[model samples]
Target: MVNMSTSQSNTSLSNGTAALYPAAVTQRSGGETWFEVGRSKTYTPTADDIGHVLKFECAPSPSPRRLISVSGIDVPGHLDLDGRISSGGTFTVLSYNILSDAYASSELYSYCPSWALSWTYRRQNLLREIVGYRADIVCLQEVQSDHFEEFFAPELDKHGYQALFKRKTAEDNVALIVVLEAKFGNHGIDNPGKRQLVCVLRSSDGNIWFTSVFNSAPHALLAMGKVDPLHPDLAIDPLGILRPAAKLTHQLPLVSAYSSFARVGVGLGLEQRRKMDPATNEPLFTNCTRDFIGTHDYIFYSADSLTVESLLELLDEDSLRKDTALPSPEWSSDHIALLAEFRCKPRTRR
Candidate 1:
């Protein structure tokens, strides 16, 4: 069974703005727990991103193919973000962990044919999966450093996104980067004001909110607190974020597999948006679990200024059934892609 994010009652601000938020949730026992990690790259999403979708899209394989830009399982024809973004806009962000090429070393990963794990095949496949979504902001984990600098950075740069990277340590692999489209302006539609720095943005009415788009695509298959003590890494996920102090904000539930963990976080603000369609509140699960299959990835956001809209549910996970674990007959990788849609609060008259 899949675990989707349940809708919560919309919260009202002191000014009577109707805002939406994921119900305040915490990890349950033996549940998804989080720690912190730093970025190889960081960026501030500008107003240019307002009218456009900010996707945290993952490359299908990181070997070949990439292009653009969405809605709840929406296509370019259906996702109308431009009109709304001019005043208040909606955009989708994704968090995906396309398994890396190093999986051949794992005994657990032997179920699949070895050739499939080749970076070239997986890279190209990952690119197809990512660009197919046309998301605005993309956060990916388990990305090898060399691949990110040589392929992802240059390739995505062609797609109009600015890239930042944060390598885990000086080891076999490098850090993951956060990518955002830089085609738009400095401030949200109206504020032509240049940002002093890319951390927070101030709307026309002086409502200051978060500046950076938060994402972590760690390398491990288990949550930080749930690491396997018996493992060589002392149960610690090599590509996982395990330090809270390193986290800018608390975020959603995450699981692991070949490319299991990835996420995006946002600050809260007040808005006057109407109630969201519960039917569209989708799950962010991209990886299958042991007993019950559910989301291993997520996007935790504050409804203070952004309105929740349709989330991306491209295909049925059950339908795309994997034979063994991940990287099986069903899907190329063990994890699925995760996406979220949000409408930035419209400029308010002062």
Candidate 2:
């Protein structure tokens, strides 16, 4: 099913009169043939749509000041992976730094199209993408505090997710953590300290710990001599291999999920390799923008107790550069989301 969204809600339109606001679907192939598919905000393609390029147009009844039309090549339906995909004792986690509306200024993202950066359009796109992932746990950074309470929280709750937000006292941006209603039992989350958010899910399999991080160690080293000098506790070792002189320690045996992706023959597959950078064996860039393009987000898990099942396919730099940078018509934020599916390891009899 192809779902589309517009600033104006079409919920109140009558059946026969709904055609007044047509959502046209056309195919670009075969010498540009136009098909009278439907006029609703959603379209379900048939078998005939397999090899054709599909486009959608929604013209509102009263028509706005400008024409609102979107056209794109239609891709095939999702692969049938019920048997191949992991189930039971396994859950997916997604980490995304959805750029805050306050920071999405025209000056900062000049390369992005103006319409695509509008909060109205971006929020809908962001929500659609987030829900589409169907992740059990979601961590969002650069979230506007007000949007979390007014938009994301209420909307995600409808999908059975409970939200926990951490906002800086001096800033409007916040970090949001939402977990799906677990079948095993209720989940517990706590903010032990500032700038760090930790969520623990209690299940029959055991406890799964999930954390979202925006570490700037590398960038901080390049910019200055120290990392987050203002927040001493937040600093991490520039190179994760060595322990910092301060000896920041934790009891949890956590591991970097994607770093394991970098290990040769660990989780790398033909399709996964094609999406990663050859030099680093990691996704090309988590955050891509005009001035800078690099990885700035991560989803870490307790590796000792869990195993990686599969990861969300990453999009390469070329595809993201189509609009010069991110916040494009298709992608809503400057940073692409990171998702990893993990299953619990059987407990050993000690």
Candidate 3:
């Protein structure tokens, strides 16, 4: 479902310099499901893995690329990913916005056709896309409570993932109403509320990257004017609401000791752009049954001590905001998923 390219460079760690850090390959007959995120054999590194590290990264599905072949594995043949708490040298984090079922009744649903929008259909499709990524840490936004308690939580649990949910502040009313209404609702709550989910994971070197759904790329652009004159969507005014939102979210005054970094969707291919929520103007994605398009999602890392190796094949590479007609055959959700690879930088030993 995603396309990827690879690049390899030799950078060794000795000591002193600290950086936060963060997949492997398999060779098999064409057309078979070569790699299954939690069920298949990814790799079995030999003695060659003692000190050398190889990173394999990809956004899975039918069209998957090896992405990397380093010092030990995959040079001569294919190998599976280690999938341990750490992968010898790297770890991956993924951010996805899977559209919730409650609000999936809009025009977008009709376009991809009603069947694909059905909970049964989209559920499996979303699950396939999500698990296919095989990320160590996954941050999800807009998940409905029932779906979480029933579907995602239990499903991901089978794969050794521990799920945590951050309930939105506005959903308190919806729950109370749902309780009062009792059996009046078909799917429990007409408005199931949106939440954020994070998958806790460890890296080979024990480095952690707090990559999540907050829009944190505002600071990375460094516009000459207070706002980004070049990029209108990212533009800001001296006292605009976004300026403060950006400052509080990305600056992390209390956590300044940690480094921070994010990538702007500016240069990303057009297809990878996000859908927009007509109400708040956030990208319509991660939940499409809504409307509009924009890249309101972002991944931030503690730049002080982390090193990002690759942010691979973003979906919707050529699709842009002007094309917000969701429920398309190309994407199951209004939003597209973003995958990034990372690891702790090797330090210069004293």
What's model 1's lDDT at 73?
Answer: 24
Q: Per-residue lDDT for 1-350 in model 3, tens only? A: 21112222312222246411113222122432122223333655444234443434332233342222112222222222442222223567777666667757745355456766667557756777778888877777668887788788988998878998766442121110000111322221222231112121111111121122222223222211133334333343333444443342323211110111122234332222232233432233332333443444444444433345555453332342223455544455666676656543332223
lDDT of 2 by residue, 1-350 (tens): 23323333332222354442244421223344344445467777655345544556532121111111111112212112342322225567888878889889899988877877888668877887888888888877777788898789988999999998876543221323323323332111111121222232110111111112233333232223344444442443233433442342344444545554454343335545555566654566787888887665555555545556666666768777778988777787888877776655432323
What's the lDDT for all of these models?
0.41, 0.54, 0.42
Best prediction by lDDT? 2
Pairs with backbone N, CA or C atoms under 3 Å apart (clashes), candidate 2: none
Which candidate do you rate higher for lDDT, 1 or 2?
Answer: 2
Q: After the best TM-score superposition of candidate 3, give how far the Cα of residue 236 lies from its true spot, in angstroms.
A: 15
- Lowest summed lDDT over 10 consecutive residues: which window, candidate 1? 196-205
lDDT: which is higher, 1 or 3? 3
TM-score of model number 2: 0.58
Candidate numbers, best TM-score first, in rank order? 2, 3, 1
Model 2 CA deviation exceeding 4 Å by range: 1-39, 42-88, 170-247, 264-268, 277-281
